[model samples]
Target: MATIYDVARLADVSAKTVSRVLNGDGPVGARTREAVQDAMAKLGYVPSNAARTMRSNRSGLVGLITGAITGAQESARPFGLPDLLIVQGIQRVMASRDMTLMIADTGGRADRVPHLVRTFLEHRAEGLIYVAEYHQQIRLPQVPDATPLVLVNCFDDAQSPAVLPDDRQGQHALVRRLVAAGHRRIAYLTLRADMEATPLRTAGYQDALAEAGLPFDPAIVRIGYQSDEEGEMQLLWDAIDDLLRLPEPPTVLCCGNDAMAMRVYGILRSRGVRVPDDMSVAGYDNHRIIAETLYPPLTTVELPYAAMGMKAADRLMSLIAGQGREEPAPTLVTGPVLWRDSVVERRAATLQSISL
Candidate 1:
């Protein structure tokens, strides 16, 4: 029921002086500041943020659209939910900037994106971020030309600015590490051929092998995972059986993700293959819950979900600041590899040219 003017009147100070004290933008004596504060407490006065937003023409609100909040379908990228990590990363940055974040969950439905977008527009969000369930190309409905938008874990045919994980680099680093540990006969079980990361990560595997002066053997690599689809388990077992039946069995097996690697462990045990003893293993997506809880623990490369979110938020903020009008090239972020007891150190890591 009270306003800044009431507090100013009771404090016997000019409205402008009271404002200076409240905003801490201009010089005000300690006694005047104390009197203003005391008057505000007495009057139970509270500043209206809505009025401030109207005056500044800045909502200080960022809109994020994702299906991760209420849970989405499990994807092959990570064994667990990665969208939550990405959202948490974005929230950290927005909070540090003193900006509010408005999130909308579509219950894992892409068809509902347009509605979320309109809701954010109605709120006058200064910037917007779209977080995908996985790394892939996306086609969005038409958004306002003036609205700054950034994509995380995905890109578009329109060449919109986006932040994506460095799939090639991450796989390359993992393979290179394997090679350095003297894993000459390493078998790779990859995601389905249709997935975007499959080709890039395969290329990385080959790159690392070539760098280590090892020959590329197609027989060792096989499609081992799909989008949690039926018949996916059969594909994995077949790949594992083929690898084991080879005359020259692999010293290590690298899987598409932590979940697959976990499955691989069980399969190998059932078939009398002891990890890091008879064979070693590696995985992608350093999902701590599965990786850390495994018997010997998992050695894997991070998917960089959190880092991608931060980069996406930063890019969106830059666009909102009017940095440029041209569509930006997708930014690539790489994550580190974690070493664990799942791998046997046949030798010290010796590859020098191998870079992540």
Candidate 2:
């Protein structure tokens, strides 16, 4: 392996000059910087991170604790690999930095977190990010006060700085759009009531209804899927059946996530219901694979998965730079509602009620 000294010799510069160029500590002229880079590339010289760490007193390391990749979440989320998008976003932002991300999977066990935290602390990771497979509240094993940490897709009661999806806002926006497109009597089939986002999204749904001067009708709302429960398909199907049997059936079915919407499509079709023509549908968590590939393409709300990850990384970077981790409210990131062919604009919308 070619060393800095070798690079310096090839570039016709002193070792100090080469070190300056490598670290970007003190400025070297643009031409000199270019020459040093060319020489290092020609010699296939790789800079020593350890040496750089020694000089800067920063390991340039960020530790990520996640279970999304391992599918080891508190429970299965309706969203198909949402945390994966978040992790990818974090990677995208950090990729430009001279840092390394060390990941530790909890293997679906929360107890493993402390051990992983200790391992990262031992390695002197400058910062840490904890990502959950779904949006929820969590209590992580204690980390040091000085160590910079950011929570993603989850938050705790302690009000630690976190990057989170604006569940309420996303749901509100999607519902508002549905209302705009002349959907009255929208039936909401939501995730289990226990999930953190459920209540928030429900509130958003109600908000849109109230905004449109519609009454809050709990009778039309039902649990479509449970994160902790199996046989969710039966639960979702029952909800759909219940809605269809209502005296004033909904014109549109809004699902908790794209996966559920996909299932709703099959259920509606099997029951001889034509989507959009008979009943329109909308979902949350615009998982493109499901949303775009669906028969008419789904109209859904996107959770800022990748954007949350990027924001978390940005926050972690700030924290690592000696920015005090003040106990600020969690940063809520919102995503847009994607309009697709799955929804049809009612020509003569009956404000009275919309029925399939």
lDDT of 1: 0.87
lDDT of 1 by residue, 174-207 (tens): 9999887878998999987888899999999999
Which runs in model 2 stand beyond 4 Å of their true positions? 1-47, 72-78, 227-230, 347-356
**Full-model lDDT for every candidate:** 0.87, 0.87
How many angstroms is residue 322 displaced in model 1 relative to the true structure, after the best TM-score fit? 2.5
**In order, how many clashes per candidate?**
0, 0
**Root-mean-square deviation of each candidate, in angstroms?**
4.4, 4.0
In model 1, which runs have C-alpha deviations exceeding 4 angstroms? 5-9, 12-30, 72-81, 324-327, 348-356
TM agreement with the true structure for every prediction? 0.88, 0.85
